[model samples]
Target: MLNHYRIMLVLCSSVLTLVGCTNEKAFERTQVEGVVTLDGAPVEQGVITFIPAGKGATAGANIESGKFVIPKEKGPSPGDYRVEIDSSVPTGNKILDTDGETMVDEYANAIPPKFNRLTELKVTLKNGNNQHLFDLEKE
Candidate 1:
């Protein structure tokens, strides 16, 4: 019957549309690791972030003893990225807590603004494992 043929055609068209929509390829990831040092000494503790220069996901990792690792499963896609490093140190001053219940030691960013807020560091990631070392200076 004509109605039966029309129903079959509609079902086939719907199935083809769904299949076409699901065929997008996934983005590839690369493993990234690195060390951070300041004034020839290892940065004791810090955080590092990688922001894509164009279009991609941003990734970050915790720095412990100047070392950080971003596994492939959670790494960023290969591309250009701007690097930001942040670390904090006690300022030797006491400040009232936000709750005004107690005093807490004041802390300030140990790394220079050029390394974090207004970063100038950049890296180009490839399609495999990558290792980079960033040695920062005081001046």
Candidate 2:
């Protein structure tokens, strides 16, 4: 009976070892750069974020001069990503002034919520240099 128990234990251990072996590769990231334009014009100011589908880290870059560059060291692993952009026009409508006033506030975001707060953009990143361009419309 003792021998029988030992054999069962060994079999179970071997099965567990084999089950742990998988062929999936580790997360791999590559450099990426892109331009963001709105209504045929370059975005003035905003941020672009790449949220991975899963099993990878999120990446983001500031939009400066209508362009953004994500370095390889700071970019997400190669995979599908959900893109989000937040754009705004400089010197937006002034309102809500300081000194407890309800005027002179400047928070004018041209892009709609569907593109930023509720984005619907998707992209597939491969294992090499990538350049993506986003053309957005205001609603």
Candidate 3:
């Protein structure tokens, strides 16, 4: 019984050491929120992504009723970010009968290609909470 206890104690100590060693430093992030509009109209449904201008995690949020909020925990650390917005709608129309009535989703770039695929909008975030409103135009 004593021998078994010694083995168990060693095993437990090893497991505890491994668990403690797994800790990694977590960085502070700025909370971000904003409204997205295109041509003076709110983007009804979509997603907004912020890619770090230099080196950092890419963060995103779902757009609902033209609003998006990125909590600090899930948002990127304070830095420059390029913004991209995209939205899609179901056309309720089939693509081709040859492919057994394949349905196609109608995708719209409400913010314009220049704002998404060719993003030109840049935002700077400071520590803590940050709020910014975006008014985009295709032209």
Higher lDDT: candidate 1 or 2?
1
Worst window of 10 by summed lDDT in candidate 1: 20-29
- Candidate 2 vs candidate 3: the TM-score winner is 3
Ranking by lDDT: 1, 2, 3
Q: lDDT scores for all predictions?
A: 0.92, 0.85, 0.83
lDDT of 3 by residue, 1-139 (tens): 9999999999999999988875366655779998988788888899999989987778999999889999988998798889888877665554654566766555444456777888898999889889989888878
As for candidate 3, its clashing pairs are none
Please list the residue runs of candidate 1 whose C-alpha ends up more than 4 Å from where it truly belongs after superposition: 1-26
How large is the C-alpha RMSD of every model relative to the true structure?
4.5, 8.2, 4.3
Clashing pairs in 1: none
Estimate the TM-score for candidate 1.
0.81
- Model 2 misplaced stretches (Cα beyond 4 Å): 1-27, 90-104
lDDT of 1: 0.92
* TM-score, one value per model: 0.81, 0.69, 0.74
